[model samples]
Target: MIIFIDSYTEEKLANSLAGRPGYFKLFYDTENCGCNGVLAIEILDQPLDTDIRISVKNFTFLVDKQQESLFDDALKLEADRSYPSFKVSSDSALYSTNVRIKDARDMASK
Candidate 1:
């Protein structure tokens, strides 16, 4: 898949991940949303065995192999600072406009 993240999204990521070393994984979070899942970005120290890596620009993202089919062949991820949210869309559909970016290390420590 192809992902194009805008400058605004880059700025937000830089601010949040400055000095942090990790891989960004676009995860299909199915924890509490029932069958219809949501997309999320989790910062990880390493890629998982089942991850499908997608490289775009200077960023590398991973998607769970099991959930790869959930996304389209092409996608664009942009940050909307006004709403303080992430937007993901494809040529034909808008997957989400409220994706979350979380620090995996922080969550694991808790």
Candidate 2:
């Protein structure tokens, strides 16, 4: 699989990885929010016991085995510095989602 991570995202990921070790794992899955089925993205430290792992651009990503069909050969992930959010695009569609950046103090309490 081919995935693109913009420079800003790469920098942020590098910093996060350095400090938190394995704090986040990119994940893609299909979910039904209301009526329509949508792709879901999650950043979690550990993968579900049954999740499948894939590597792209030296980054580890996880996806449920059931969601493998939704995985496209080409995936684009870009970080928009203007909004400080990330956008994901695949063969099917393009969408933007916010990245939840938790403060260190907040995370420490969790």
Candidate 3:
């Protein structure tokens, strides 16, 4: 799947990374949500061997090879500078309107 990140949202993400080595991940967070978990955008420093790369303008997002089917092939990501969450959608339906941004850079890498 391809995700188009808006210019403003991209700027915020870049600032969050702070020039540190990292990549974005379309995370399917199943923690407390349920079997049908909420989606999130995660920033991480480690490159995983199980990732399927989806390239954007200046960055590439990684998705778990097994969970690639959870998203639409073409999607748009948007966010308001005032809020910390994001909205992900496609032509067919709105997947999630308040997808959280989870910065996992501080967690121990696998």
Candidate 4:
């Protein structure tokens, strides 16, 4: 699959991961929503063996092996500077919008 990310989104993402030793994953979270799934940006200490890595201009994102088939061949990640959020979309429909990054490392420490 191909993913497009805007410059603002790219800068914001880079800032989030700066000085943090870990992996950035575009996770399709299926937990607790019945059959519907939601996408999340998760910061992980390391990627799972089942994760598939996709590299963009200067960033690498990980997706679960099972969820790889769910993505469209072309996807776009854009930033809404007004709301200061991230959105993921394809040609026909939106996959994820107003996405917030979840730092798993910080959460686990709590």
Candidate 5:
């Protein structure tokens, strides 16, 4: 699976973990954080037992089990100069890059 990380995000992650040793936890979860439906990215000092650690582009991602199905095959996360966040896309029609981040209240409508 090819997960593309933007230069900005990459630099940010590197800067965050430059001095710090050990593995930096990158949390990916499908939760309603705001109005739009989007994935959540969190940096943790430690890793959880249920976390799935994937190393891509010299960066580690801590994905949840429930979200693994969405990334079964080779998924790519492309990032450009304009885009600051990671863009996830897969060859499978079951999953799409059209995912939007939604808040708790917005999720209730769906």
Candidate 6:
């Protein structure tokens, strides 16, 4: 599968990832939500060894193997200027319009 991230989206993500030792996670949050789950971009400081990595242009995304089938072969990550979040979509469907960025870094220690 191929993931596309535009310049604007890259810049926005870079600003948050700058100097931070973390990995981008394309997470399918199903723990909270019912029948359908929500798609979110998570910045995790430590990723699980079982996580599958999806390489894009200048970055990589870690996703659960079980949830890998939820995405299409091609995907796009875009920036949402209206809010401090992002949007994940593809030609086949609009996954999430208001996809949130969850930074799992320890902010208290830093």
Off by over 4 Å in 1: 106-110
lDDT of 1 by residue, 1-110 (tens): 88888787878776657677667888778897887767788877778899988886666788988888888988888888787668889999988889878878566567
User: All candidates' lDDT scores?
Assistant: 0.81, 0.58, 0.82, 0.80, 0.52, 0.82
Q: Give the TM-score of candidate 1.
A: 0.87
Candidate 6 lDDT over residue span 1-47, tens digit each: 67899898988888878777678989778886885777888888766
Tens-place lDDT digits, model 5, residues 7-103: 7756755664555533433234435665333454555555568877788777776666655665655665544345344455556543333332222
lDDT (Cα, tens digit) per residue for candidate 3, span 3-76 = 88889988877776788878889878889875877888888877689999888888878999888887789998
Consecutive 10-residue window with the lowest summed lDDT within model 3: 101-110
Alpha-carbon deviation at 10 in model 1, angstroms: 1.4
| Model 3 regions more than 4 Å off | none
What shift in Å separates residue 8 of candidate 6 from its native position after superposition?
0.5
Model 4 over residues 1-110: C-alpha lDDT tens digits? 77888888888888777767667788677799686677888888888899987887787788888888888878899877887568989998798777888778666678
- Model 5 spans > 4 angstroms off: 1-9, 15-37, 93-110
Question: Which 10 successive residues of model 6 have the least lDDT summed?
Answer: 100-109
Those runs of model 4 whose alpha carbons end farther than 4 Å from true positions after fitting are: 106-110
Q: How does candidate 4 score on lDDT?
A: 0.80
Candidate 4 residue pairs that clash: none
Error of 1 at 68 (Å): 1.0
